[model samples]
Target chain A: MDLPGIVHRAGGALLGTLQHVRIPGVGQASVTDDPATSARRWRAVTVLRDQAAVGTPEAPPPPLDRFGDRIEVRLTAAPADRGTELAARFRGTPSEAEIGELRAALREAKQLLEVGEVLRVDPQPHGQRKPTPQGAALEGMTEQAPKEGVL
Target chain B: MKAATWTGVNEVSVEDVPEPTILNDHDVILKIRQSVTCGSDLHLIGGYIPFMRAGDVIGHEFLGEVVEVGKEVRDRKVGDRVVVAPFAACGSCWYCKQELYSLCDNGNANPGITEGLWGQGVGGCFGYSHAMGGYAGSHAELMRVPYADVGTFVVPEGVSDTRALFASDAASTGWMGADLAGTEPGDVVAVWGAGGVGQMAARAAMLLGAEQVVVIDRVPERLTQVRTHVGAEAVDYTTTDVVAELRERTGGRGPDVCIEAVGMEAHAPGTPGIYDQVKQQLRLQTDRPTAVREAITACRKGGTVFTLGVFAAMVDKFPLGAAMNKGLTLRGAQVHAQRYIPELLRRMEADELVTEHLATHVMPLGEAPEGYRMFKEKDDGCVRAVFLP
Candidate 1:
C-alpha cells in the first residue's frame, strides 16, 4: 500500500484498539467484551418517541428491520419520558463488518425516527486536501468513526 | 467561493473552496456576514485538539444571512439574518427537550471518534474538527447550517450584526456558565480568564444580579477591557495571588460562583505553568487544568465552580480532593447556545448587552491568515478578529 493508504488503515485500526485498551487511571471506560460476546450483545438507541411508534421487534423501523432474520430486535419503553429503547442483536456470531453495519443502522434509525432525516456532513465545502499522511489518517479515522464507537 | 482553512498547525490559509449547499432537509445555506476567531480556536490551531485535518474549514462563532433554506426549515427563511448556535442539535432529542442541546445525541455524525476519546459523543460543531462532524465552518462566503430551525435564531432588528455575532457562541456560552452555575442576586462571582467568553460571563453574572463580579486575567489589555467595557473589577493574576485575592475580595468567604473560561491551554506564570506545558507537550495529559484548579481552590465552601472552557481528554494533577472536600458543585458543558441565544438577542436588542467592543479587529475573509496570527499572539491588543466573508 502507498504511505497514505497504510497510515489510513493504521488510523482506523487505532480507533478499534482504543475501544478495547484499558489502562488504569486514564480513560479506562471502554468495554472489552470478547468478539463472540460482543456479537451477541444487543446494541440499542433511545429514540424520543412512543414504543408503539418504534414498532415491535418483528416490525421495527426501516434500518433496524432491514437486518431481517439475521437479527432479533427488541423495543421497550425507556425510563419515564425518555422514549423507546430500540435494540437488536445478531442471532448468530457475525463478522466485524456486519457488527459495524448494525451500529450505523441503529444510529440512522434513531435519526430518521426523531429528525426525519439522517444528518449529512459530506459533499460540503473544503479547501485543498494535500496528500499528507496525517490528513489521510484523519480521513480514515472519520471514515471508521460510524462503526468504531462503544455503541 | 472562498474559505479559510487549517493548512497545518498554527497555519491558516484562504483558498478557493466549493460553496456549501443544503445537505439535510432542515439545513440552510448561509452567506456568512461575520465570523470571529474564538479563544477555543487557538487550541485547535496549536494542534492541542489533534483532530483537525489540513484543508478543513476552522471557525464556529458567526453571524450570517440565510440565502437558501431547505424544504423542512420552518422558522428560518431566505433573507433572514441569523446567528447560529455553535453546536448543531436536533430539537426532538431528549437532551434538547431538557434544554441541554449541546449533548444532543443526533447532532454528531462522526460519533465513534469522540466516543473513543471521551467515552460519549457530544454534539457536532461547525468548522470544528472531523471529530466534531467535519461540518464546513462559517469562515467562508457560503456555508451550510444543519437543523436550521433549532440552531439558527433570527437576529433582532434592533441588534447590529457586530453585536449579534457573539451571541452565537461567546455570549451564549458565558451565559450558560453563569446561569447554570446558579449565579444569584447579591452573590459574589469570580471568573478566570478575561477573554471574550470570560468577559461575557462576567457581564452575564452582573446581569443576573451578582453584587460584585471580578474577572481574573494576566493580559493587561483584557483586564483593561474588563474594567472599562464589562464594568467589572479586574485582577492581574500575574501580580496578585488569585486564590488569596478572591478570598480577600469576597470578605474571606471566596466567591459563590467561580467560572473558568480559559480552556486546556491555560497560561500560568510559575513552575506549575511550566510543568503543565511540559507535560502537555510530552502527552502525559491532554489538557492543562491551571484555571480549573485555581477555580476549585478559590471557590467558597459549598460554592459552585463551572468550567465554561473546553478540555480535551484528561488532565494530570487535578484538584479533585479540594473539589470533593469543599462541597463544590463542579460542572462543565459545551455551549447550549440554542437555549440562550433567543434571550441574549433580546438583551442585545435592548442595548443592555453590548458586544461590538469584542470585535477588536475586523478584516475581510481573505485576511484570515493575518487575522488569526494577530489574535493568537494577542498582538495589537486584539481580543477578537471578526472576519467579513
Candidate 2:
C-alpha cells in the first residue's frame, strides 16, 4: 500500500506535514461550514489513510464522497515552536481532482521540510478495512451519526 | 479415577492421571480436543512460580469436546465444543455475581476452583503451581471441570482455531490490560510488551479509539509486525530510552495508559543479553521487576498502569511512590478468561478484530518443549507459539 497520504493538518497532533490540501468547491464548503468550526478560519477534517492503497488497484485514495471528505480545517496559529497538534477530520477520501492539490498542499505545508517519508502509495490494504466490491474502487466507510448525543 | 500429578516443572507423565468421576451435580468430564502451554507454564520452568511440584500436568489454556456432564449441569452437554475459562469460580459467589470470577472466595487449592467473589487476596491459579489451586492441567487429552456450564465457554462456529485458541488466556489477559487502562477515544496509549497479550491490548486500545498508539519492545521483527499490521508507532527499547521516547511522542505527558505485557521476567534492557542477577536469587527486588519498573516509569503522570503479565510472587520497592505521587492507578492479575470470551467472539465475528497474526510459530504438540524454549528465548518472531496437539 502507499504510505498514509496526509489528509490535512493544524495544531497539536495536527502539527506534522501538510499531507493533502482539499479545496474543491464542495470540499471547501465542507471545511468552511462544519458545525465544529463554524466561526473559525478553517474547520477542515483531513483523513490519514493507513495506506496509499485503501480500496483496490482502481480504488481512489480516501476522502471519497461517501465518507464526508469535505472536512473542516484550520492553519495553525503562528510560532511553530509552540507545539500545538495540527488536526483534521479523518473521514473519507479525495477525488482525482484533490490528489494534485494534496501534493501541492503538502509541499507548502511542511513546517520543517525534513520529515523523510513524504508520500508513497501502498500495494495492499492494511488492518480492518473492507474492500470495495468493484476491485479497488471505493466510496469509503460512511461515518455513523454519533449515537444519541455522543462522540 | 487416577489423579494426574506434576512430574517435574513441566514434565508430566500422564500415564496415571485420574479419571474424574461425578462429584457435585455441576462436574463435567472433558475429553480434551486441544490442550496447550501458557506463559504461566513458563513460570514453572523458571521455578519462579510458587507451589509447583514434579509430575503435575502443566497446562491451563485449552478447549475441549465435552464427553460427559454431571446431573446438575444442564446448559453444557456431552458433545459441546468448549474452552475452559482458566479461572474457576462458583457460579453464585459474590465475585461471581459481580462478574469478578478470578477473585472468588471459598477458594480451593486448585487453580480452577470456582468460588467466585471479590478477592483482594493472594492465592491460587489453576494447574500453575502449589500456591494456586493445584488442579492438574490439560496437557493430556482428558480432564474434568466442576461448575462446567458456568466456567466453560462455547467457541463460535466459523471462527478459525487461530482466533478462538487464545480466548481462554492470552486474548482475555490483554483485554484486561486495556480495560484496566481506562482507554479513551483519541487518547495516546502505549503498550510495553508485544506478546500475544500485548498485541491484543494495543488492538483493543485502538477499538476504544486511541488516536496515536505506540508499542515498545526489543524484538525487531515483532516491532515490525505491530507497525505493519496494527499501525502503532514502534519503539525498540533496546535502541532507545522507552520512557524518554514515549514522553517525546506524547509531548512529555507519556501515554494515558501504560500496559506491562512482559510480566515477571521483564528484561530491563530490551535487547535481552545480560542475565538478571536477581533471577539467580529466590527473593525478588526492584532490579528484578525490570518490566514493571519500565512500565511504571513510562506511564504518564495521572495515567493508569495495567500489569497483564503475571509474576511468580509480588516484588519489592516498586516506584509505588510514583504511583502515589502521580496519582496513577495500578491493577494487576491473571485474566478472568471466561468473562471476556463471548464479547471477543462477537467482535471476531463482526470482523472488528483478528488474532491470526499472533501465531508467529505453530508446531505439533511433540515440539512443545522446543516451542517453550524458543518462546522463552524469544528467538525469531516467537511472540506466541501454538501447539496443534
Best by TM-score: 1
lDDT of 1 by residue, B1-389 (tens): 98999989889999999888778899999899999999999888999888888888889999999999999999887999999999999999899999999899999999998888778888999888888888888899998999999999989788999999999999999999999999999999999989999999999999999999999998899999999999999999899998998888888999999999999999999999999999999999889999999999999999999999999888998898999999999999999999999999999998889999999999999999999999989999999999998
Candidate 2 chain B, poorest ten consecutive residues by summed lDDT = B110-119
Quality class of the docking in candidate 1, CAPRI style: medium
Give candidate 2 regions above 4 Å deviation.
Answer: A1-151, B1-6, B9-18, B110-124, B270-276, B279-287
Best by DockQ: 1
Worst 10 residues of 1 chain B by lDDT: B113-122
Interface RMSD of 1: 1.2
Per-model i-RMS in Å? 1.2, 26.5
Q: In candidate 1, which residue pairs get closer than 3 Å at backbone N, Cα or C atoms, i.e. clash?
A: none
Tens-digit lDDT string for candidate 2 (B270-346): 33324454443635332256777777788888888888877643455567788889888888877876678888888
Q: State each candidate's chain A TM-score.
A: 0.94, 0.23
Candidate 1 structure lDDT: 0.92
